[model samples]
Target: MIDDKTTPCPFLGEMVVMFCQAYPVRKPVPKHLITASNPCAGKGYKGCPFFKDIMAGLGGATGVDPTLASRDRKGVTS
Candidate 1:
């Protein structure tokens, strides 16, 4: 059973990018795949396999920040 009372996954990158940072490498998740099973899409993500796969001792990392990702999409340059 999933717990509806919870915040979304922090491992999820930009709202538009739809990627999972839980993997060893960033995995691209399609918009269509954002179902109840998608922990990043809704609450109760702790039950997700990818979420559970997180290495032990890892904490306080939000992965790709949405603000930075949006800047990247806009073509940030020095």
Candidate 2:
């Protein structure tokens, strides 16, 4: 949560940075990154670097589908 406001673009001073890798273009909004505490939720996913990256399939370092991850966490197996 780098919401210092002094930070530059791509570093919108949010937790999104911790879950994403930088890209030339903006990133995409990751569903997994969306939480009740996220400030961007109300603002939508426009001009968001992390959101753009996720849309381009370059974001989310979790390496696992969020749905699957949740299921796994619950000990649910296919």
Compared with the true structure, model 1 gives a TM-score of: 0.37
> After superposition, which runs of candidate 1 have C-alpha atoms over 4 Å from their true positions?
1-17, 53-55, 59-78
- TM-scores of all models? 0.37, 0.23
Tens-digit lDDT string for candidate 1 (8-67): 676865644466555455566667778877556667765666565452323434574433
Regions of model 2 farther than 4 Å from truth = 1-39, 58-78
lDDT tens readout by residue for model 2, 1-78: 787576679745544332223234335576667776674655553357654555455334545453353233333333
Q: Which candidate is the best by TM-score?
A: 1
Model 1: lDDT equals 0.53
Superposition error at 24 for model 1 (Å): 1.2
**Residue 31 deviation, candidate 1, in Å?**
1.5
